[model samples]
Target chain A: MGEFDLIARYFTRPPRPGGPTLLGVGDDCALVQPSPGHALAISSDMLVEGRHFLSTVAPDRLGHKALAVNLSDLAACGATPLAFTLALALPRADPQWLEPFSRGLLALADAHGCELIGGDTTQGPLNLCITVFGEVPLQQGRSLALLRSGARVGDDLYVSGHLGDARLALEVFRGQLSVPAAVFDAARARMETPTPRVALGQALRGVATAAADISDGLVGDLGHILRRSGVGACIEAEAALSVIAARDALDAEQALGFVLAGGDDYELVFTAPPDARAAVQAASAHSQTPVTRIGRIEADAGWRLVDAQGRALQRQDQAFDHFK
Target chain B: MGEFDLIARYFTRPPRPGGPTLLGVGDDCALVQPSPGHALAISSDMLVEGRHFLSTVAPDRLGHKALAVNLSDLAACGATPLAFTLALALPRADPQWLEPFSRGLLALADAHGCELIGGDTTQGPLNLCITVFGEVPLQQGRSLALLRSGARVGDDLYVSGHLGDARLALEVFRGQLSVPAAVFDAARARMETPTPRVALGQALRGVATAAADISDGLVGDLGHILRRSGVGACIEAEAALSVIAARDALDAEQALGFVLAGGDDYELVFTAPPDARAAVQAASAHSQTPVTRIGRIEADAGWRLVDAQGRALQRQDQAFDHFK
Candidate 1:
């Protein structure tokens, strides 16, 4: 089939009634009715072969990761996932590849209530781009969009879930790391299926003032919040001791290095008002996701890592850089 | 500099407040409040290296063409241009490349009063996708969207501007054609700089029903209108004789062939009801654009060409298709 015919067969659609999708795909333009009493949040990400993913990666995983990354951005913003548009560039129309790719994309989109709206498919090298839109109640003012600039001095810093599995998954794929079968499976799952903390984000709406997803490592992402909010941070070296203790092979020092510098955790790192510690605890309870108080916001301009004795620890920032 | 820093220095901006900008850039989402009583028109296009352009094409031209093609779609929909978002993927952080590219995109965006809104920049192989939004009047029972499904049997078929120069320019670039400096200049200009018929699109809002831009040759693009409208067309070959007369060293047959099958013209091909012919004429006069009466729609399912003698003329459909 031709490119246009394939698009019509697989992607042409309209929004279902009684859902987040006011208008689905299939037209020259999709009519979107923003949810009443909510502001829209939008983000776009593109993945290219040899850049974002290896050609050997499964089509299903590629599709899942494409949507997952965008969803993670929504998690950072505390927005309800709404819809997305996909633009695909392929070397040729391979139905075998397209079928599983579509299945994987639809599966995640269905689970998240993110309707696959409009898209364009054409012949080119493999490049996948997805633009996603979400909604947040506007009545709460800046509560919906958790800005990177809201962290105040003396505020507590927190991170949800573990880190470094994604980067380590890449190492496994590249044959640089060998592990037990169970550990390998866990790492692969983490790499292929990133669980975006959307629930945690929504719960943190009114509780956490500054938030960002750890796509570029906790240190780099938190640095964004610090720079934007004009504040510093003091991260406790022993805050994630449980994650370090759970490690069977890696040491606390090495795991701490990854927690701070490893990328692609798809977890929320946020700062809450000092007086709202109880609310922050309550918010994490709502998500049923573990919230680790890793650090505190400070008045200085430099980020510091301190031991229990209050001695500073020298650390290197190894955030993911696409061009690097 | 890093890729993130490069974007911050160049593309990270909201449009300055003025003109048609309801909301500019710089946030998680760009807010756009169109003029009251106007329905928004939106379209998107993605251009990939080695597929949409040669590697040697100027970066500025690539930026201009990316936005221009989407603008042409809005123009076909009878919308006034408003704002655009660019999703750019690059192989590396090259400052020299980005400066000119942003300048070109901003120049066109400024000239058309279309603001540059929020977008993403990342490292990948060269892939650039642009999504543009425009606005048109909203009136109950009054059609403003120039749909592809409104053509009727006995309705007139018309096209704005001349054709074939763009395809000829490609041939010239490939060293397959040699001509005088003047003809070469005309053809090259048609390829390098396309003028989207925005004025004509606005004027045709009330005058025409079915409309589309000619990107994939006259016959192939018209076929889209025919398929959507459920009608056929009978073209008067003599009607396009003027385009042939304007060319040198080419017979009528060659010129007609080029006009029918050559792509990238970016002109509007539309149909109007017999009763709206006067309005179409008035629109043509107002815009100072050439609107030719080319054919009439038919109840049959296929388009046919008839010469001055009323005899069928055989022409091959040779529209450009990235994947055939």
Candidate 2:
């Protein structure tokens, strides 16, 4: 089938029957009416082969990761996803691949309640760019957008979930690691299917002062907060490795190293006011996500990694760089 | 530099002062407040190396085309360009390439009155996607969106500008065509820098019943209008080739073929009711754009290509299809 025909058959949806929305799909442009009380949040991300993912990665996994990463960005900013448009560049029209990829994408999109409103399909090497739109209330103090520049001195730093699962998954994929099939499967799943902390982000909207998803490792990402907020952090090495210890993924020393420097975690790292520590604790228990207070922010010049004995460890700034 | 550092140095713009917008670059997602009386129009386009352009294509032109194609989609819907986000996938981080690209993109964006809000920069093999936002009045008849499905029986069909320049330019690029340096330069400009019919689209909003930008050639694209509107058309070969005839890009007979079957013209084509014909003529005259009546929509099922003498000629259903 032709590109137009394929789009019409699977993608087009009738305009939402309502007051504000006008068009949805199957038009040159999708028409939307902004809600009276909210501002529209727009973000776009592009994933390409040999860079974002390997050529041998499964199509379904690629689709899931593509959407998940974008959603994670919204999660970082405390935005609720509403709709998205995709621009797909494929080497050829392979229905078998398209079906699973679209299904995986649609499944996640449905789960998140985001409408796949519009997109474009073209011929090229595998590349997918997704632009997501979300909403945040506009009233002052009502809609607090999380920024990397909001960290306060002496505020405790926290990270959600475990780190380095995705890194391990990549190692497995590259044949640099050997493990049981189940372990391999679990690790691979973590890399392929990221869980965007959307609900956590919303819950922390008014609570956390600074936040960002860990796409490029904890140390490097936290550095953004420090540089932007004009503060520094002293992280407790043992506390950072708690997850790796519980999962038996690595020894305490190795886990600490990985958690601080591994990329593709897609977990939130945020800061709260020292007074909001009780609220942060309550949120951690209530939200059913692990939140570890790894360190305290300081009015200083650079981040410092401290051991249990309070000795600072000299470390290199190891983080993911797209160009690197 | 690392990704974070690169983003800090580039793609980081503070919120603009007193613009018709909300949120700027540097944030996780851009927040946009559409004009009070307008409905938001969105369109996206993806350009990939080896498919959309040669690897040697100037970075500036590549950036321009990435945004222009998306703007063309907005133009097709008779929307006013407002803001755009780019998702660039690059094989490597070269500051030289990025500076020129950003300059070109910002140049067009500034000229078109669009703000550079937000986007992603990722490592990949030369893939670019741009999503553009435009505004159109929501009032029913005052700001009608032109769709591909509004042609009716006896409605005149027309297209703007010459055809085949882009394809001819490609021929020259591939060393198949030997043309004068001046002509070659002109054709190359058309190929690399397409003039989207934004103004003409705005003018046609209230005057034309149906419309679309000619991207995938006349025959294939007109087929879209026919399929969606459930109508057929009879083309007067001589009349449809009139604009190209003036250009003398090809002989009258050859120009007729290119005008009907060639692709990437990025010109406006629309159908008008008989009663609205004079108004269209007047609008065209005031806008300094000629509105040619090339053919009429029919109530039948098939497109018939006919000479001025009314003799039908066999035509092939050949046009650009990404997945064909």
Judged by DockQ, which candidate is best?
A: 2
Off by over 4 Å in 2: A19-21, A140-143, A179-181, A245-247, A281-287, B1-10, B140-143, B245-249, B285-288
> What DockQ does model 2 achieve?
0.73
Q: How do the candidates score on chain B by TM-score?
A: 0.93, 0.92
lDDT of 2: 0.79
Q: What is the lDDT of residue B100 in candidate 2?
A: 80
**i-RMSD values for every candidate model:** 2.4, 1.4
Residue A282 lDDT (model 2): 78
Segments of candidate 1 deviating more than 4 angstroms: A18-27, A36-38, A139-143, A240-246, B18-40, B136-143, B241-246, B285-288
Best by TM-score: 2
Whole-model lDDT values for every prediction: 0.77, 0.79
Clashing pairs in 2: none
lDDT of 1 by residue, A252-286 (tens): 77677767876777888899977888888888898
